[model samples]
Target: MQARQDATARAVENADNLARVIEHDITYTSQLTDLSIQAAVDGAQDADVMRLPDHLRRELLFDRSATASQYIGSLLCLDSRGKIIVDSTSVVPRSVNLADRTWFTVHRDNPKLGLFVSRPLQSRLNPGEVDLMFSRRVNHPDGSFAGVVVAAFRLDYFQNLLSGVKLGPGGNITLLQDDGHVILRYPNDGTPVDENFSGRKNFERFRQTHETSFLGTSGKDGKERLYNFRRFDKLKMIVIIAPAARYVFADWTSRAWYIGIVTALLIVGMLFAAQLLSVEFRHRLVVEQQLRDMTRIDGLTGLSNRRSLDDRLMLEWHRAKRSGKPLALLFVDIDRFKRYNDTYGHQAGDDALTAVAQAIARNSQRPGDIAARFGGEEFVVVLPETDGAAAAVVAAAIHAAVRGLAIEHNGSEHGVITVSIGVACTDTEEVTDALGLIKVADQAVYRAKASGRNQTSMAEPFGGAAVTT
Candidate 1:
């Protein structure tokens, strides 16, 4: 239940954020449209019809895709007769008749309309792509209404805005006008373009209320969802962030499975103690514990095995992301381990490896931290909520602990055996995958060896400098 609540809270927060973004984009595009209109009016003041100066034309024609506010794909100046005078997209403007377009006709019919946003449609310049035109009435210098100034905003703009959002499998986010036209839907191959949802219960409820959030079933798929919406009054649109109910309850299901497993273990233990009460029961308990441990424990070092590390890393990664914390990994390798095995024989090498593993286990004191043997003279320590600095300190302590063993090594630079430690950490925002952390830590270990063994090094997140000790 707690897991379900957490998921819902996260979904609500994410929805709120997405709503703000959509609202802001609407306002931004509206402002840009107004600015474009003013520029057109200024440029056309003394023209035979509506002519733009060379500089003004170039400014409007400038490619905005490379810049931050490149949402506007193209701009155009039109005459009162709805004839294209200047197209910002081309050096030599092409003649396109816009007199029949809704945005053009609407502004042409009504001179009082300040800014009009049209429904999604294919662009005149690029017929393959869908676009929305934000247009405003352009009045002639003599006060009569000239043609409309149009700012064509590609639908790709909205797609880019919502691309970074992560809705788990089967989840979806959508942008819809209050009139029930679907502007965009993610995981769609542009098939839902201008889809009318006016008759859908969810759309009707969304339009009828001024609420920011709603819980309902999707009319399209019958999947129950928690929908959070923000209305863009200027654009007459709403951005809906919805995650499927099943996805939201996934964590709760995982928790229930864990609870069931623990209950079964408790029942088994109780039955053995109450009924079979003797030496046999005690022996059975030990055997059962050993059998359970075998799957996740290293037989030689008595430390957690690679399988345990993988599971713990996954769990800790999720916890760190949810808690907005950091997770650190220490990849420790015995320096010149192969040479030591060759010189000291396999038995002595094994003893040294066991001692090093014990030191690492002792140093990772936190209940949430895990120490595991990652196969053949390599071990890993996982520290949840620990940053790079703290992990470095732990790395230094592990170095000292292992050095205290004083296991002789003739092949190593140092007289006594030492281990190279590589530390890597990821903050909540940077948590893309758990495997990335391991790869980074492994690279850091390689750096430690390159710089001279018996040292501690930290891998910088996202290819930054490596800090060494």
Candidate 2:
């Protein structure tokens, strides 16, 4: 009787150790996957997917996470109505409406549900394969539901991870949602995925506490087994490792000395695997950060891209509004750029553009200021807390810097490259929002061009004349 009791205690201890290893693996995977989804969300907000071309939009929203992770089946962005607007798998999203899907509805209905893990379900995109989805809610600037960013993982991936460990006869590993829905089970015994075990007596213990290991009867097979379970409160996940009590006792009786040595070796191997995964997780985070930084910069001139400009403009607009401080915008356009391209080859034009962009970047060196290539030969400089006069001084400095480069532009009357500058300030009564400010600044640019090629023009205050410097 004493020997039997000792074997049971050893079984419980082994199962508990194994459960901790599985929990570590899963927690890391989930955190990394969620981080990828969040990156997608931030990208979506920075770029307007609706206006972008299919391939460009997909590239903007999904990064290496889509293709780099072996376990991830796909990454997706759905619209407010649950229409798939962006998909990582194809340039063009599949024509599928997931309005009825539980994951979609949960996010759409619950604004505060930051991250969610869905029950296992067959993938609609990949017909034969089952998936477990990790999703986060997307919201508009006003906090209305915009959509969801989803990362789908193949159910087989979890099953394979769980099956790697050797368990004696009638041994099994199960992953469950907090609600007791089985996500995956190793050595599948024909039990359905997503089968609810909340009502089972064995699961009752898990609901009552964070971790446990004991001998209990199998709720399904009616056989005695040593069960070990661990719960992740934040992730709402549960992992269970169970081996039949009969097998444990028989093995212990026949080779008690060998059992301890084997268990030690298995534990070491699992710990090593966990360490490797940790290293991989940290490496992925670094890669993701680099990718995000790449997206915000213009490839040609090394200036802030249009997408980045939009985000910064919106952010500054709100800050200026709240603080009641003046915000200034400068619109700089290369004088007769098309003629410059015609006179010099496209490569020379690119060089000239880069030089001009650097000049503009140099003048707006304030920490709060942003200089961006608006598009082509057009550039914008955002100056926070600056009035029209200060903005014009910055614009004049940019004008002088371009003239200093003295790049030959035979197409221009000056016989050298020059730029037209338009300055606008939010202190004007007519400017109501960031878009309005941009429009005013653009009109000022046109006025500067109309006056001459190398000058600065500031938008007129209400009921006043335009200022040219």
The most accurate candidate by lDDT is 2
RMSD of each: 34.9, 41.6
lDDT of 1 by residue, 157-194 (tens): 77787788787776787788778788899867454689
Best by TM-score: 2
* Candidate 2 structure quality by residue, lDDT tens digits, 1-469: 5677888788787877887777887788878888789988887765476478888878877875754357998999999998899998888788999988899999988999889888898999899888999999888888888899998988767777776787788988888888889987888888899998898888887567544877789978898888888787778888888888778889556676577678889999999999999999999999998788789999999899999999999999999999999999999999999998987889999999999999999999999899999999999999999999898889889989999999988889899999998888998767889989888888888888888768888787882436465
Question: What is the Å distance of residue 73 in model 2 from its true position?
Answer: 1.0
**Would you list the clashing residue pairs of candidate 1?**
none
Q: What does the lDDT read for residue 32 in candidate 2?
A: 81
Give the TM-score comparing model 2 with the true structure, all chains together: 0.52
Q: Where is model 1 more than 4 Å wrong at Cα? A: 1-6, 45-68, 256-469
- Pairs that collide, model 2: none
Q: Sum up the clashes in candidate 2.
A: 0
